[model samples]
Target: MSDYLIVGGGVIGMMMARELSTAGADVTLVDRRGCAEESSWAGGGIVSPLYPWRYKDPITALATWSQSSYVLLAQELLEETGYDPELRQKGMFMVSVEDADDARRWAAKHHRPLTTVDADFLYQKEPHLKENLGEALWMPEVASIRNPRLGRSLRQSLVGRDNVTVLEHQPLESLIIEGEQVKGIKTHKGEIRADKTIIAAGSWSGELVKPLGLNVPVEPVRGQMMIFKAPQGLVNRVVLMDGRYVIPRNDGRVLIGSTMEHTGFVKETTEDARASLYETAINIVPALADHPIEHHWAGLRPGSPEGVPFIGAVPGYENLYMNAGHFRNGLVLAPASTRLLADQLLGRTPIIDPAAYALSGRVTSG
Candidate 1:
């Protein structure tokens, strides 16, 4: 019997498993398809949300904490696994002025440095950007990581750990409940008993927890992204216009993403979305129009009602916890969310107030 059985092998689940195993708990992680191949792998990996000031406190708290810890975490992972997640602190450039005032206010309140740059400075920073694009906001402290690399490194780091068991391609069928407690989980293979169970199943978390009568409200929000092969310095930093973004990797690949669709569980990439993203990319950086498209794919983000993830005990159930509904920010928020969930499970005080993320807390818009 395992001390903890985590359902889902996305970044959130893997991070939770790592934390639990590091703290001397025997943890078993099961994934339906494969670990980290879902939203965690498909995300753009910007360390902060597209518009940080737009989200409420509950969402910002976790994001900020995780953002603060990513540098050290990346260093540790690099040392342990020799896989650089390519943690880049090149900063984020915002071109949209729709919510500039609101963003400025929030930044001031939160002590985040938000600078307004003129056209000359913007062109100096990112020469490839479209000319005549007026003033923009520069968030200097923002950073990004290669999310797929990070996920792979986390999995690699767990290979020889005696306390961790990672099971891929094991789809969970149902939960084994006894009165008010969750006994274990029923996978396609067979029954596996556990002292506690955590559902970090990403977009599929709602279906897995529905049998237990816990309405987690986690639904699949499909986001499609396109990759373009370019020179290493084709795009100098992360660029944003409205909700879409362009991320340049250490390698010569530039990632342009994404569209949030309400389609239910369908991960297919649409040509329309591809074209739309291509147009958006070229609109920001005209040079991208000359680049060849390398790849196009989609992933389903675990979206909650208010875009905030649940990271606490399941109401009315003992030994059951959840860490899902992160929507588009899972990659950025995973570190802090996992720490908070692990602390709660181990009877330790959480780094942030757990009330806002509790299962019973009132849902608020991000």
Candidate 2:
């Protein structure tokens, strides 16, 4: 019997496996498809929330904590796997000034630096941007990572671990529950027993735990993205306008995304979504209009009621835990979120208070 059985092979599940295995726990991670092929692979990789000032303190607290630990984690992964997640500190430019005052107030309250830049300064910073965009807010501390690479490196780093076993192509059929405790899971292949089970299955977590009478309130929110093959210096930093964003990779690939549609579990990409994303990308940096779209894809984010992830034990189940519902910020929040869950499961003092993300907590939408 394994010490823990984790259902989900995204970044969150992989991170939890790495942590628990390092701590000498027997861990088995099972995924429907392959690891990191879901939302974790398809995200824009921004290390900060979409609009930091617009979220509640609970959400911001988790994001801020996770952002601080990303650099160190990236370095460790690079050293171990020779794959750099490309943790870049290029900062982010928020183009819309409608919420500038609210953003400034939130920044002050959170001790985060937020500067308003005029058009000239913005042009100097991002020369590729179209002219006459007025002023923008500069979040100098914001950073990004290549999330797919991060997920790959994390799985690679755990490949040689003696205590970890990764099972792919195994869809979880149901849970092996005895009264209030979950003994194990029934996958497509066979039964695997474990002392504890964790539902890190992202958007599918709600269905996985419904038999236990736990309402995780996690659902799939489809987001589509378009990749543009541009010059390396096409966009100097991450450019954001409204809800759409354009992220530049170290290579000549610029990622333009996305749409937040509550369309259940559908992960299909639409021509309308592509056109909208392309128009938005061009509006931010007009030069991108000339670049050819190399790829277009969509992923389902595990969105919750208020965008805050659940990262603790269920109310009545002692052996079952959860770490899903991160919405679009899964990659950014994975390190901290997994660490907190691992600490609680291992009976150690968590680095952060886990009460804010409790399963029974009230949803607060800011």
Candidate 3:
């Protein structure tokens, strides 16, 4: 029996396995499909929440902690594995912010730098934008990672470890529960026993635990995005307006995203969503209309109450744990969330208060 069994090989599970395996624990990570091919690959890789002022304290705490660690973590991953998870400080422009006071309050409380800029500043920074773009909130410290590369680096690192095993294309059949103890998981191939089991199955987490009489309020929310093949330095930074965004990658590709639809595990990309995203992208930067639409895809974010994730022990099972339900911020929050779960499992002092992300506490707060 391994020391840990992680179901779902997305960012959360891979990070969890990486953490525990680094601590000299034997870990086996299984995924229904290819690891890191789900939401972890399809995200915009923004290291912060869509709007920092919109979320509560818990989300802020996790995001801040994870953001702070990403630079070093990316470096470590690159050194360990030869893949570079392009972590770039491209900053962010929040155009047409509704409540400046709330944003200022959140920034001041969190010690994040925020500046107000007029249309002149917007045009001067990014000349391709449409006219009368108006004022925006500039956060110069914001950064983003190329999450698909990050996923590859993480998978390589995990596979290289002597204490970790990764099984892809293996579907989890059910949890092996005896009384209140979850021994391990039953995959399509066979059952694997472990001292502890963790469910990091993203949107499928709710269904995985429901048979055990736990109604974990995690559901799939579909988000679609389109990419434009623009030249390098065309779009300078990440631009957010009206809950939609355009992210410029180091390579000439720019990302335009996304629509939040509670469509119940439907990962299909709709023409309506693609057309809407294109319209938004062109309006934000008219030059994008000249560029070719390279790719349009969709991902399922694990939606939870107020966009907070549950990252602790399961309610009824002593040997079972969870690190899912991160919604849209999974990539941004993965490092800190996995670290906290590892801290709890290994009896180390947690990086933050464990109660806020605990399953029972989340249920109560919800």
Global lDDT of model 2: 0.89
Candidate order, TM-score descending: 3, 1, 2
Model 2, span 1-366: residue lDDT tens: 999999999999999999999899999999999999999999999999888888878788888889899888999999999999898998999997688899999999889978998999888988988777889999998998998998899989888688899999999898998988899999878998899999999999988887766666899999999999999998878888988899999996899999989889889999899889989888888888888999999999999867889999877789988999998888878888999999999999998899889886642222
What tens digits encode model 1's per-residue C-alpha lDDT throughout 150-194?
Answer: 998888877668899999998988789889999888888999889
Q: Candidate 3, residue 258: CA error in Å?
A: 0.5
Best by lDDT: 3
Candidates' C-alpha lDDT: 0.89, 0.89, 0.92
TM-score: which is higher, 2 or 3? Answer: 3
TM-score of each: 0.97, 0.97, 0.98
Model 3 lDDT vs. the true structure?
0.92
Model 1 C-alpha RMSD vs. true structure (Å) is 2.2
In model 2, the runs with Cα more than 4 Å from the true position are 361-366
